[model samples]
Structures are given as structure tokens and as C-alpha cells.
Target: MKFAHDVIRKPVITERSMEGIADNKYVFEVAPNAGKIEIKKAVEEIFGVKVAKVNTIKLPGKWKRMGVYRGKRPDIKKAVVTLTADSKKIEIFENMM
Candidate 1:
């Protein structure tokens, strides 16, 4: 079994993600098959934050139809993790020049 910090990718940057961060939470798009424990571990290892709680959401594939073709958007798994009150801030956005 994987610890709660090995399957996280990076902090996702979106309007919704920014909103979450403003509320003291961080958002990430995780491996589709990863569980909560793995996600938590990955976040900790990558960001060096103490995870206080983890919430996951599995988005269903969306249908798409076109002329002579039909397919669906890929599904995605997302996680929202809250950090401990005393944990340092994670600088996901840095100056890159």
C-alpha cells in the first residue's frame, strides 16, 4: 500500500483552484486510479505541507458527437487537500523569467 503522498501531480491552477486556495485549500488533478492515501502522501512530498484533510472528486466523461465521429471526453480525478494551520505556504506560482 502506498503512503498518502505518492500519487499527486502538482497544484492545479484554475479559477476554481484559486478560489479553493483562497479558502485555505489546495487543488490538484491526481492519477485517475489513485486513492486518498496516495494522493495525500504525494501532496505532502511534493509541497512539504501537512495534509489536514483530503476530498476527492471523480468527473464523468462527457459525451461528444461530430460528423461521422463520436467520442467522449476523458474522465478525471481531482483532489482538494487542506493543510495544517501551522504548515508553511506552498508557492505554486513563482516568477519564471
Candidate 2:
């Protein structure tokens, strides 16, 4: 697999994701075309951490209503990377005032 920089774009920050990260797991909104192996490689390389496990989920697009037309949200892929106990940390929020 290619290095993480070419696979994962960036980490996703949100309420739920922050909660997970606080528990020692990090979440990211990965490219829809990326898979588990790709995600694993990306996280390890980009974060400089030891990836113990990788989990992926594909979220279906949501339907939206319009007066005379309808639209759907784009599908997205999510990855949860679990790091080794002694791996380096990713401090998402250092100083936000």
C-alpha cells in the first residue's frame, strides 16, 4: 500500500469523534475509495504511530426534500484507527482560544 500521506487526507473533528479519540481511538473521514489496508497505512505513516487495528464504515447518502426536486447527501467513508499502547499521540486540539 502507498504511504499514509497519499491515502488519508486529514483527521475529522466533531463531537462524536472527539469523544472517541479521548478514549484512545481516532476517527477520520476517509476517501470513499480507500479501504482498510490503505487507511491503516495512512494513519501509521501520517501520525507516526503504531496502528494496532483499523475499522472502516461506509455511510449511505441521506435523502433531502425540496419543493419540487430532491437531492441526496454524498456518501462518505469513515475509519477508526486504534494505536498501540506506546505509540506517539496525536494532539488534535492544543490551543484553541
Kindly report the root-mean-square deviation of model 2 from the true structure over all alpha carbons.
2.4
lDDT (CA) for every model shown?
0.77, 0.77
Candidate 1 local lDDT, 1-97, one digit each (tens): 6544447655678777776665568888888899887777787787787999999999999999998899999998889888888887777643210
Error of 1 at 68 (Å): 1.9
lDDT of 1: 0.77
TM-score of each: 0.82, 0.81
How far out, in Å, is residue 43 in model 1? 0.7
Give the range where candidate 2 is weakest over 10 consecutive residues by summed lDDT. Answer: 88-97
Where model 1 places Cα greater than 4 Å from the true spot, the runs are 1-6, 93-97
Task: Estimate, for each residue in 1-97, the C-alpha lDDT of model 2 and write its tens digit.
Answer: 4656657766777777777765567888888888888888777767678888988888999999999899999998888888788887776633211
Distance from true location, Cα of 85 in model 2, Å: 0.3
